[model samples]
Target: MKICFITLGDIKSIATMKRALGMANPLQALGWDVSIIALDSEENRSRISIECNENVQVHYYKDCSAKEEVAIKTRLVNQICPDFIYFCSFSFRNRIIKSKLKHKPKILIEHSELASSIPDNKGPKKIALRLLEYYSVYYADGLLCASRYLEREYHKMARQLMKKRLPILYSPYAFNNDVIDAARILQQELNERYKNNTVLLYMGTMTRNYGLFTMLQAVEQVTKQKPDIKLLLLGRGRHLEEAKTYVQQHGLEPYVEFKGYTPENELSSYFDRADAFISPLNDTVQDWARCPSKIYMYIPFRKPIFTSKIGEPKEIFGDDGHYFNTNQPDTLSKLIAALADGRLQKTDVNIDEHSWDQRAVDFTNWISAQYAVRFAAAGSEVFS
Candidate 1:
């Protein structure tokens, strides 16, 4: 079987790229030809490095303008004629690609919370984009969701468009084991620097939606009892400066370290040194359906987790760690107190269910089966 992935972002270090590559690796191992065609941007082009693996080819179609992008994509589809095309993140380019390729089975995968994430986005431009998103989702041959909550929202939206059901599949975000190893190395190095303090690591982009400020607040509260609580924050974002200022003003310079944006290959060591992974996500409408990919990385270390009860976190990490009230610094402080006393269980969450290799194998098998059924029904010759 031949599978081609169509993605929204430049196929670089983003979770979209990671998950696609994770899925592709297993399919390729099983004798399937997998290729990724990404919308190349200067930002991603400069950073993306994918060594050509056997049975897998990564292609980037570079067109700065949207019109040129569509043309480039159309040409690639015509040339490749892949049996299956998985679209990650809805786009106008997908409409063009679907129209140009009459026979290819297109699958749309949504990773974020779409509907309630756009309540105030009711202007003409927002409405137009939502309509496009809705249409692409409703018309796809198959729909894949990263979270069950998001799947429920997707079903509700599809029903509004007279679509009762979509051939929906579940695919959560995941990391390559190689990347996990790198995080372990970084963790050891950070462990040496912070000496005695337990490093509470938070990876991924630091932003308002991700609850970075609340983490800082939790740090301030925890320091009084557990002065040895050191925070190692990775990744950069719009809210980095604000978080920095908060750390400085609260006299947390000795306790908090902002190790901004490490490369993908050099992250596992950090995961190794982490005593706990913290994500204080709130119960906003946006947070309800979203699944942050960081939890997957945090789990492989088997370190205890500290997070708010939002989205799939509760379902995935139930009783494995401590859960705090979103936006409540007091509750976070209480959790920290319990942590110092070894009250929270350090047991591993059952991430065997969320393993990247398992997820990839399942998805590839289902895709192959679906394609076989379609081919047989259409009276096409099947290959042994």
Candidate 2:
């Protein structure tokens, strides 16, 4: 079967690109023709180039006016005549594209709850965007929610719109095998630098909602009892400087190290040397919808993961990792102390089910089933 994957983001976007390719690669391996349609931007054009394989086709469109871009996408879809179209994000243009397509099955891979994430008082823009998101969900043949919580929420919303149940798939974020192999390589220097300390690693955006400050606070409390605990943060964001200021004000310089914005390929080296992985996500609509891709990225290294009992993490890592309640720095401090004292053990839960290959196979099978149902409804034979 031929499948066309579409994303509104530039091809070089770290998370989106990786996810799009992750799903495509496995489909290609299963002898399916997969094509990725991405918005072209100078940022992606300048970064790197993809070596498209025989089974997978890559197409990038130059930046254009909204009307022109939609027209170009419509033309491309007509030319490709794909059996299915998978969208990576929701936008007005994408919704319009869905409206234009008559027969091809479409799937919306919702990575976030965009409507709730938007702050209040944006006026008509917010209303329009929310409606677009709702219509996108209401009209799609199926949904690929990044977390179970997201699946439940979107399923209810879509049911409300259609007055019937819609197909929803729980496909969490995952990492490719290259990341796993790279993390297997050890860096002697980093290993030596962190040899004597209990290394706690946080690798993602340094934002408040992600609990960067909460982590710092917990680390500070942990260090008061165990000075050998080290917190290694890797990633850059708008709140990086603010976090640094808090570290300074609290005299956490000796306990914390910020290795800003490490490339995805080079992340495994940091992951290799860490004693544990941490995701201190706060409870919010935005976070509830988010399936922390970093957790999958950290899993291959066979490390203990520390996270608050948030939506996806709680559902996925239940009893496997250390879980804490919201706003409970004292509880987090105890977990850290246990790790520092070598009392906490790394989780040995089997992660084969979460692998990209498995996720892709599941997605392909689901797509096939959806297509069969559609064909049956129309009294036409489905593609084999």
Candidate 3:
């Protein structure tokens, strides 16, 4: 089977790169010819992909103009001629999806988050986004869901809005074990500076929507009880300066450390250095709507993962996970304090079962079944 993924992002870019590559890699391993069609706004950026997956072909199409992009995409899709094409991140580049070819590629819509319900969006723009979301979702022959909440919601929405049920597959976000294995071999020499201090790490966006303030508050309280605890955050976002200002105003310079924007390839080194991790997930509409990919990244480390009991984290970790209320700083602080005083220990989680290889098995089986159904309806034969 051949699969082509279409996403709006630069080569090896952040937005859709993680999920695209995660699925593409395993599909290639399963003897499927995989191709990725990425769109970049930068005209200067090279069309070549420097990703580790050599088997999977990466074609970056320049988004200079809609007409030019369509021409480029049309030519490339004809050349790739995949059995199916997946339009990711609510992107509706359906000129090709609606086109004719020998393969007669089936369309699959893959959503990582609730695009229309994105936080801080308002007014006319929000309405425009909702319309766009509805357009692509309405056109899909099937849905590849990232979380169970999304699967249920989208399934119901299809029936109510379109009066037709879309075949939904719960293909949850997963961790790349390749990075984990590489991290295990690489031991970042952090003994000189952080020898005595217990490093509590966080490695994603620094925005308030992700609960950066709640984490800082918890860290401040943890520092009072356990001064040796150090909260090392390793990402940058809109709230970086604001978070820094809050840290300064609260006299938390000695306790908090913000190491801004580390590359994905080099993240393993820092992951090896950290003793424990924090994911300040909250109970909210936006939070409940999507699966947290960070939790998948944290689970493989088998370290103490301090997070809220909500959404995918609750489902993924079950009893093995640590739970805390981010709304209550003291409660989150006490959990961090447990780790600082040797009360909390790393878990022996069965990380192998959750690997991309495992996720690929589920994806391949489900997608093949969906393909068979599509053929069955059209009075055509399915794959072997």
Candidate 4:
């Protein structure tokens, strides 16, 4: 089967992009033809040119008027004539694309609810965007939610919007087998770099809602008592400058290191050096809907994780992971101290079931079943 994956965001070193590639790679291995369509920002184009293999066909479009962009997408859809189109998020463009297609199945892969994710977004614009996103979900033939929380929420939303139920699948973020193998080889090198210090790693965009400030505050307190503790912050975002300013103001330069925007393929080397991983997400609807992509990466390293006790993390990690309240920096400090003193125990959960390959197979099966049910209900001939 031929599948087309579409995204309006940059495809370079982003979690969503990596997830798209992960799904595509496994499908390709299973003898399915896969192609990617992404917005043509310079950053995305450069990354695609360097990282994507020759076998993977990629089409990029420069910034254009909304009408023109939709036209371009319609043309591409006509040309590819894919059996299915998997979009990375809900957008007006995607809604139009879904309207244009008659026989092809369109799937929305929701990663976040934009209105809540961007704390700064307010007023009528936010409300309008939220409605657009909800309509996008309503128009899609199916949904591939990143977390079970999202699966339930979007399923309900879609049912309410369409006045009927639509097929919804749970396709959480996961690790690729090749990436895991490569990371294992760099373990010794990473260990030698932080010889005596208790290294704690965080790999994601720097944002306020993600609790970068809270993490810095906790690290400050932890280092006061345990000066041997070190934190390596990876990835870049809108809050990078603000985070740096906070670090400077708090005199945390010695304790915190900002390693900006490491390539997704090279992240395991950084993950290998860390004794523990941390996610300090604030309590918000956006966060509740999110399934941190980094957790899948952290799991294979066999290190302890510290995260907020809410949403998907609470459901997936449960007692196996260390939980903390987002408002309590002292609690985080204590958790860090526990890790530094060799008191915390690592979770012994098997993660092979969540591998990208297995996820791809499951996704494929789910799609097939949905198509079969639809076809049978309509009393029409199946595609193949």
The candidate maximizing lDDT is 4
In order of appearance, the predictions have TM-scores of 0.88, 0.87, 0.88, 0.88
**Model 3 per-residue lDDT tens digits across residues 1-384:** 677887665533355556777777676766677888876545213322323367778777755666566667767778898777787665434345355454567788887677667767788877887787667667778888787778877887787777375678887777887668664333536655788888889878899878799889988887877889888898888999999999999999998999996656567777777888888777876677777777788778777888888888777777767888877888878888888778875566788777777887787778767666222321233554
lDDT of 4 by residue, 1-384 (tens): 667887676655434676666777677766566788878887776655544567777887777877787788777877787777777765666434556665665554555444544567778778877777677665677778887777787777777786456788888888777666664555677778788889988888788767787789899999988999889998888999999999999899989999897765567677777889998767787788787877887777788889987777777777667977778888899999999888987677678877888887788678768775222321232455
| Model 2 Cα RMSD, 1 decimal | 4.0
Candidate 4 clash pair list: none
True lDDT of residue 27, candidate 4: 71
For candidate 3, the clash count comes to 0
Off by over 4 Å in 2: 11-14, 41-54, 93-111, 117-126, 163-165, 183-186, 373-384
Tens-digit per-residue lDDT, 9-73, candidate 2: 66434455556677776777665678878777765443224323455676788777777777777
Clash count of each predicted structure: 16, 0, 0, 0
Which candidate number has the best TM-score? 3
Using lDDT as the measure, what is the rank order of every candidate, best first? 4, 3, 2, 1
RMSD of each predicted structure? 3.7, 4.0, 4.0, 3.9
The local distance difference test score of model 2 is: 0.73
Show where candidate 3 strays beyond 4 Å: 11-13, 40-51, 92-103, 162-165, 183-186, 345-348, 373-384
Candidate 4 wrongly placed segments (more than 4 Å):
12-15, 41-53, 94-111, 114-118, 183-192, 373-384
Residue 263, candidate 2: C-alpha displacement in angstroms: 1.0
